[model samples]
Target: MKKLLFFFLLMPILIWSQSNFDKAEKLFQAKKYQEAQPLFEEVLKSKPLDIKTMDYLGEIEAHQKSWVKAAEYFKKLKELRPTTADYFYKYGGCLAMRAVEVNRLKALGMVGEMKESFEKAIILDPKHIPARWALIEIYLQLPGILGGSESKAISYSNQLAQLSSVDGYLSRGRIDVYFERYTLAEKNYIKAHEIGKSKITFQKLYNLYLNKLKDPKKARELKQKFES
Candidate 1:
C-alpha cells in the first residue's frame, strides 16, 4: 500500500517533466533555442537516456554556435539510436559548423569535410530539406577550385522551389539577384511575398528592385503593404 501511494505521488513529477519537455520543443520550433536549451538539459538530468533530450540539446547548441559540443551530443544520440534521420541530419550539421569554423587553413580541408557532412545528411535523409538547401548555398558560395558548381546549385534550388516554404523561393530570388538576373529575381520575390510577406521580400521589392524597375507607383503600393 505504501509503494502504491509513493508511485502515485511520483507520477505527477514524471508528468511535469514531460510537460516541460513539450514546452521546450515548442520554444525550439519558434526559434527560441536559448530559452529551450536549459529546459532540455533539465529533462536530460531527470531522464538520462531520453533520446529526445539529446536531440534537442544538439539542435540548441547548433543554434548557439556551440558546434563542437553539438557534435558530441549528436554523436551520442546516433550511438543510442542509429536509425533516426534527424540524428544523422543534426550530427552532419555539427560537422559542417566545425568545417566553417576551421575554414582559415592553408589547405581546403575544412571545405571537403563540410561537403562530406552534408553528403552524409542527404544520404541518411533524402527529404531533409535543410540539407538540400544548405548544399545549394555551399555550391553558390564556394569557388570553382573548391568544388563550386553553379549548375548543381540551380538544380538544388529548383528542387527547393517545389516546396511550399517561402524561404525556398526567397533563396532562389537571392541567387538571381547575385548574378543580375533581375526579371527572374523579381518573379521569385513576388512569389515569396505571396506565400509570406516577410520584411526581406518587401524590402527587396520596394526599396531596391521596385525603384529600379521605374514602378514608383507600385513601389509606393508595396511600401504601404509593408507598413500595414
Candidate 2:
C-alpha cells in the first residue's frame, strides 16, 4: 500500500518536470536564452542528471562569454558523453578562452590541454572543419617557443583545401597576409573570389587592395561589389 501511494505521488511531479522541460526547450529554440535559463535551472534542480539540459546550459554560457562556467558544464557533458567530438571541441574552446582570461603562467599550463582536446576532436572526426580551423589558427598565433610554426599552419591549410576549396584559398590568403606575402595573398584571395562571391571573400580582397597593395581602384571595385 505504501509503495502504491509513493508511485502515485511521484507521477505528478515527473509530469510537471517534463512539462517545464518542454517549455524551457521551446524558449531555448526561440533564442530566448535568458528566459530559458531559469526554467532549465529548475528542471536541473529536480533532475540533476539531464545531459541535454546541461548541454543547453553550457551553450548559453558560452554564448554569453562565461567561459569558466561553460567549461564546467561541458566537462560534465564530456563525462556523460565521452566519445562526442563536438562536446570535446566545445570544452576545448571554453578552456582556451579561460586560459586567455588568466595570467600568462596559468595560460601556459592550459595550452597543452587545449591543443590535446582539439587534436582529439580532429582525430575523432577528421572532416570537422571547425576543429581543423581552430588548430590552424592556434598554430599561426603561437610563438615559435610555444609550438607556433608557419609550416604546420600551412599543412593544415592544405588539408582544409582538400575539404573545401574556398576555405582552403581563404585560409592560405590569411596566412600569407600574416607573413607579409601580399602578392601570394592577393592571388589566393582572387581564386577564392572566383570560387564564390561571399561578403567575407569580397571584404578580404577589398582590404588587401586598399591597405596592403594600395590599389585604390581595385579596392573600390571590390567595395562596390560588396555593398551591392
Can you write out model 2's per-residue Cα lDDT over 61-110, one digit (the tens) per residue?
99899999999998898788888888889999998888778998898788
| Whole-model lDDT per candidate | 0.78, 0.89
- Cα error of candidate 2 at position 159, Å: 1.4
Model 2: lDDT equals 0.89
Runs of candidate 1 exceeding 4 Å displacement: 1-47, 98-100, 165-168, 195-220
Determine which window of 10 residues in candidate 2 has minimal summed lDDT: 128-137
Per-model TM against the reference: 0.68, 0.89
The reply for model 2, stretches above 4 Å from the true place, is 1-4, 210-216
